[model samples]
Target: MKETVKTKRRSFKHLVPPVDLTGRIERSTRMDRTIHAVAKAVRRRLGPGRLRDLLHGVPTGKPLHPPLVTVSLGCWVATAVLDLTHADPRAARAVLTTGIATALPAAAAGITDWSSLHREQQRVGFVHAVANLTAVGLYAGSLALRLAGDDRRGRLLSFAALGAAGLGGQLGGHLAYRQAAGANHAESVAHLVPLGWHDLCELKDLPDGRPVARRLGYIDLFVLRVGEGVTVLADGCSHLAGPLHQGRLVSEDGSACVVCPWHGSTFRLSDGTVAHGPATAPQPSFETRIRRDGVLQVRPAPL
Candidate 1:
């Protein structure tokens, strides 16, 4: 029998991410002053509320910016197809205008999400915003030129806009996947936690009316004891894994809530659901029971 050798195909997942530009940008503190000023302004302007939560896609349970961006990019690409095929100039202008118009809401959600990110994420996001804004400006000029009966120049400007938009989109992808910005940082807790009740601590040992951190297998849990009632939730903020144990516990809407110290994402203690975002995903909450031996035990709550 003859032995045959076969070559294995290269897997995309096995390939390393192109992070050179992002690493340099993340390390360079050249724009820290400007980044800080803009970040503060955005946070103040887009503070936690119904309107802000809606923009963060808390209601839809997804980031609105990502999906909204597709509409604008799709229209711009359609315009490019029309221009390249030497199709009617009026059709190209119509699609280009639509892309420009839809960019407003997409930008609104993008900036809102950017406001609650880590400093490093914000640095990359600033550059991403600049590239996108440049694209919008170029597209707007393209529209103006078309209206002025300069189809050739309009097409040229639109092509430039596509380049800028593509650059912005690439940076956005890096943020979403590599940096894990806007991702559910605490999503793995349920998977790692074992079924059945795990011993937490004796009820009397818990600090009264204070939030504290406790270990539950691989997950760190945020435990709060107010009189006889106990609330247990995964200790990581669902946004960026900000320490919920280090957060401020306050009453909002007549319910106890913990505000993430890092990005201010708020979760209601009752069921670990987002009362405010930047965190579209809910924290993993647990059900507790006190054993006959005075031990407090908890298990993952039913979905």
Candidate 2:
């Protein structure tokens, strides 16, 4: 006769308490999905072509949201401090008004950037937006109370608004630093690829009128050939790290361009200028030439 023992299989679910944790997780996941879907719809209606570019600071070559947020939040913080310290009421009123006004554009820019992010990043951004909206409401209430000559309630509301704003600022920092929502996706390509010309491929290997992906050291390069000339740009789109090599080549406004596969950010081939975007930064372009040996070589262009 043999004795046999049965053992239970291990599962991570076992570590979870016997509470309603599953239900809570399901609800949170559903909300996140809803938020992501709503952001996608808003982005489509807003159009990521030109208007989004303006919001993203493509013309200025940096994210506009950061500076705008700094000013907006700075004013609110100053107002809160002034109120707490029994400083000039007129100055506090002025700052609160300015903060409210500045927050409008800052929120707009933030939403524009938020719309282009992936689902995980969008979830964080959604909470961030909600917090800021709450702060704005509190500040508005404070302003109205101040106008009604209720200094005590106004100061209290301002304090609450400051707390909400601080929470929102913390989330914004997470989005920028942890999730990299507004950072350049292809910034590393410049540093990774050597400055000198590196042989890409033979001229015949790259067909004319097609966007081909090539590797130069650790960087992926998008190569396009157009009638006796070759154009090379970083393959990673600046917005959300979309693959430009898989994008369509189109002539927009008489300039050769490539549109991002993920977000449709269009970049000019000649100089890597942003043609249309949710992408704030331009793609890094490389200078290309065909040597007598029929080898195509590319090098980082001067900034």
Candidate 3:
């Protein structure tokens, strides 16, 4: 007697990503570490003050990367339009020159932002930097050739540069929108929660020296009680939205502070001031009170 055997094939949809994709991620991760180390060394050599301010956009409400990228990429777009139409070489050259000038500041701002990101985000950012650098090289070559009166070669190089820039722009969008790398993590908490006092918990439920998590609607809050007074802040860290309740509580300059578990950015619990950074913005602090029912309450601080 003979026995029959049967096997069912797996669906293509159930298959995992190819091994090469995993290899690419690993390689990018290694490069991310190397880039970060090099950047740190360069920063140490430069020291601090104006250079740091320029990189972090200390004078601006947000990270400088977005505006710098917009200006440089906008110039490139104008040049690309001119190239496609075979417009005047002088006009194209002027646009390309402006783009090149803005590119340096954009790269500096991007590097500054990238250095503070987590490992996974850093992996994406590293590939982004490489793509941008390649584009820069192509554009620089194109500019040199154009200046030398070799319009044919210069135009071809500009097309290649545009392709590289498109790839880098895609990665940059993923970093900003998907990864939330440079977002103001606590901004939403300001609007979503009700304006008046919302009861958090009973005074007895809170621990004396520890932070407790409380949720109201879409907002998560970190509540800390010290004797009769309570401090309430948005649970998300402004840097990367790290859970503040999980962070260690410490005193900085005689004020109670919470250190973000992700990036070590510290915030004063009382006023939401940035005591330390990587975080350019402050945490969202709340006004707290003991309600008539003896329940703890919190409201968004006055603007």
Point to the candidate with the largest TM-score. 1
Question: What value does the lDDT take at residue 219 in candidate 1?
Answer: 84
Report, for every candidate in turn, its global Cα lDDT versus the true structure.
0.91, 0.85, 0.83
**Over the stretch 2-116, how does candidate 2's per-residue lDDT look in tens digits?**
9788898788998666865323332355567678777878787887466778888888888889999999899998997898789989899999999999999999988888887
Per-residue lDDT of model 3, residues 165-259, tens digit only: 99899788878887788888888887798798888889988999788888877988888888988888899888888999999888888998998
Worst 10 residues of 1 by lDDT: 13-22
**Whole-model lDDT, model 1:** 0.91
Clashes by residue pair, model 3: none
- Could you give candidate 1's per-residue lDDT for residues 1-303 as a string of tens digits? 999999998889747666678888877899889989988898888766888989899998888998889999999999999999999999999999999898999999999999888889988999989999999999999999999999999999999999999999989998899999888898899799988989999999999988999988788999999887899999988999989989998888898899999878889999998888889999889999889887999999997
Task: Give the Å error, residue 179, model 3.
Answer: 2.2
Compared with the true structure, the alpha-carbon lDDT of candidate 2 equals 0.85
What TM-score against the true fold does each predicted structure earn?
0.92, 0.88, 0.78
Residue 252, model 1: lDDT of: 85
lDDT of 1 at 30: 92
Residue 239 deviation, candidate 2, in Å?
Answer: 1.9
| Least accurate 10 contiguous residues by lDDT in model 3 | 18-27
Better candidate by TM-score, 1 or 2 = 1
